[model samples]
Target: MSRGTDPYVAGAMDRRIALAHEWDELVERVRRLGPRFASFLAPPRTQDFLSAVGDGTAVLINVARECHALLVTASGVTAVPLPGLSAAEIADRTERHLTALRRTDLAAQRVHHTQQRARVRKVPATYQAHHAAKIEMAEAQAELDRTLLPQLAWLWDTVAEPVLRALGSPARAGAEAGHRIWWCPTGLLSFLPLHAAGYHDGSGRTVLDRAVSSCVPTLRALARAARAPETEPAETDKLLVVAVQEADGMSPLPQVDEELRLLEDMFGPDRLTVLEGPNATREAVLGQLPQHRWAHFSCHGRQDPLAPSTGGLLLTDGVLGIKELGARAYNGDFAFLSACMTAAGGLSLSDEAITVGAALHYSGFRHVVAALWSIDADTATALTGDVFGSLTRGGRFRPQASAAAVTEAVIRLRNDSPAHPSRWAAFTHIGP
Candidate 1:
């Protein structure tokens, strides 16, 4: 019935915006109070410190209160499930987000040479305790959305409108080949890992496949790359194919096979091969990993707390665990993990394990393309096809351009008729 599965997500966002407004007001008020410990103590530092003078006092307390209010309001309302991420997952994301915020604060200090340290006391006092508490609240908020929204699909059914779907965007002209992009597509999932086999086991079939035709054009485009009369993708040590999947489930091999067939049509079936069953073991995947120049998979990939290496996508044989694989060391040509959450790098300050896409990059692949957030399969199908289409249609076979093509398409869709930004902005391009 509701457009958003979790009202808390919107509420949390609105609260954060309101808090930002409050932060500005506090900064303004403090300025009227005159300089901190007044002196000719660097006019700029004084101004900067004054601007954030009460932030230390206000932000933490207010944020904590907001969390408390969320818990209460959520219980009283329509009982809309809150979309939340796990603690570590939340930390990974929020920490990175906060790190940016922290950096912004730090940058101001750079201009004010007199202020050698943080204006927010930088002490581990009760005030700092509250700050930590604030972080916990935000993390919880993220986790709530991460956990609930996926499981409760009906929450957004009415929200999906077809008004903007009719207008297709203009195609970009010319060839721009700078970066390599490896694309992973999710057929359809509702909290199911696209790559993991569990999807097939439990669910009958995804409605997403029929929503749009992703297999034909997307595969043809990549196959065209394989058929390139000139230019070959550089290979350092081996070919890195980053197969993306959800945090848990079976590999998305069967669905990938259909597209693999499409690839064979262009590249010829003999040159193309598909691995299955017990042969899909990690060892087998690894053995094949170093040999192939190009590889593609459809699955789910995750980036979470604890360690980056532990984060991995679901595969046919158990989860294709990344922690054990250690992607940074692999040297490959190009790989695409057509799964959700593959683009995520280390959240916060921590250097996460090779994210689905990053792992390919670190694994020595020249180019990697991954999505930033959980994308709907139907949306992914259309987006991935357009991206590969750009390359197949005479554009440079670079990941950067391909990925940008996707974003541009969504932008075009939005500009033609403003649909939800979340529908398109969810996808992101990663790597050099």
Candidate 2:
């Protein structure tokens, strides 16, 4: 018998068609219930889902027992199998990353102590081990690089390179300015730096090299950011600079003042609402968010390892935790969080992508620049200048160009210190 005339094949086709029709009927019935009911339902059509992607390609990846990447573009959806990745491998690597990160924190502390001690004319007897601390810091940094570099290379070979190949090269795709790629990583993958995935040994085939990478907690989050109304110029064009130079109980960020100065020069005083020191209270910052089109938080950010939601940008009065950030839906364009670990998620809740940076994006900032780990204060200052300089070029607040701007700034930083991934790899853009 011919394949078309086969009973089993015909039965399967009929069942599929019947199920599709029934699904459509059910969808229509739900729609008829009212706008509230309909709002809960996702659009049934493929094009409806594709529309949320905008000009960029959204790669929603699942790294679980079974690993795969669902690439959504304007054209359609395509599945790219991540055969090299495994659940066990991801789990093991994530643990290693956490260990290395902790070591990094210790190293930073030692380095900071050494610097503080050196500043004094006569070193106190209690802090006489400053030289020893410096040596230990260097050793710790070397140890961190060993794990971090290999992880990047692994991600490149297993995940990024294949996905990039499937999407086609930026040159071939006619995206010399860097093709925007929204990384929607799930599970353990959320903990890894997919944006900085690459072989850093002068191989121009890195994720940063090919695409202007931006992260979204989920596809829905990206759509929400896209659908948010733009803040009007009539309301305010002010770039809110919330520089908390020294939050109580935290190490002082001396470069924050310099960052504010550079921002003042790049964007004049009239265009800014400077809230530094005691003025950048949680209430004040939240109040000012609604009035500004853009924001820059030059302060220390804290990440709670056990309770992710407790993580927030360290302000003057208190820490602005993630849960409190959603008090109002903002219409702001962009936010630059030049602080430590603004983008780092909790180890226990690695799948949730719960962080201060994601909270800002959720709160309605279209584009957010954040750090995946602790960043150097000097590097943060320079990077902030580069980012804002790009955003406010020709005296225009162009928030749409933020992702590309961050990419360029990070690339510049990477080029300057090719051997140090810690300096450049931490900063990532989260948005559409």
Candidate 3:
């Protein structure tokens, strides 16, 4: 019976059990240390967070009743009130917007299969379903515009503008061109696009108008990322680019090929290890993660509302769940997720920051770029290419400068596609 069993498998199982016991012992020891040591184990203090901002940057923490804006400049930190926006209102609007987006996506799928469905036996049912979906999408679009725009304007007036004023309004000194602000919204506000909040009446008053926007899961996360040691760009610095365009039971992302080709050109084929199509398995990607300084995934992302921690990037073999991700220790600089809804935290786990972006942050990546909602393939490709281009300009990869690089890249996309907030607003930087 011992000879029949695989020795390697048995050895791995033994190691896992030993590790589990060690982890349990460590946890018990920590518990015995009591509440005095708990603060040390917890997130950093407000002063530590203020130091992380490092001039010309602010951090916004949105809670249930109201939002707190911490304007951190070279001098000190100033806490300001973001009035007229509550958690309940944010939750309502988020649900409405997400529902509208889902309807629109279903309509798009129906439209794509219209010609194929026309040839099927149940033509009438297919046609009726498609037509009904189209009508639903139109109504949802109208409703979204009617309800969401006003809320965005209100957010701009109440939250963003106040934060801007507290920071001395970077727009006045032409500082908006270079200044950055990191938004750290809690609860339901995580689903809303605080970066795109603006008065849509052609007033040119928006968050983007004042400063480039980025996001962080927490101020403590930002502080930790800022303290990450900078490494010089070398030939040994490898990038792992995973593209799952043809996964089973999923629509093919034909544009991902072009995206990968573009990335290869920017990062050089010698430095990038491309795991694409059938080879982009969960085990393959996870095994290679520790070897690379940067990783980019162009695939589908599923956010499990009921079990947010179980949600992950959809690879060829299976989902690369956040729980699996948190088990790894990495020293990577960034993880750029060119997938849909990578930053959409479930309502129940809203304050917990249980999303792919946050997972990457916790997994030891200094910076993470992920989407707040589903993004079109073409737009994602363009945005990602521009981001990499900005980061690697003049044949140098500056990981420490990712915040500005990501912000500027998104700003460029917003300028080119001014009418479509969905295109430019979905992708956001989630750390320093």
lDDT (10s digit) by residue, model 3, range 1-432: 287889899999899999999987786688679775655444467776767777657566656455677666547777788676676677787778777667666665665566346557466887786677667656655665565577678778768888777766655322236457888887778787887777644455777666767788877788888778787765438889999996655567767898899888988878899999899998999899998889999998878655788788999998988888878988889889999878888878788888998998888988888998767788888888888887888897776677666666766776785656667777788776
Ranking by TM-score: 2, 3, 1
Flag the better candidate by lDDT, 2 or 3. 2
Lowest-sum lDDT 10-residue window in model 2: 169-178
For model 1, residues 68-114, the per-residue Cα lDDT tens digits are 10111111211112233233333343444434333433333232322
User: Model 1, poorest ten-residue lDDT window?
Assistant: 56-65
What lDDT would each prediction earn against the true structure?
0.39, 0.83, 0.76
- 136-232, model 2: which lDDT tens digit per residue? 8778777777888889999999899889889876632212466779998877777788998887777676887888898888787887777676655
RMSD of each: 24.0, 8.1, 9.6
What TM-score number comes out for model 2? Answer: 0.87
| Candidate 2 vs candidate 3, TM-score winner | 2
TM-score of each candidate structure, all chains considered together? 0.42, 0.87, 0.83
Order candidates by lDDT, high to low.
2, 3, 1
How does residue 216 of candidate 2 score in lDDT?
Answer: 85
CA shift of 11, model 3, Å: 44
Best by lDDT: 2
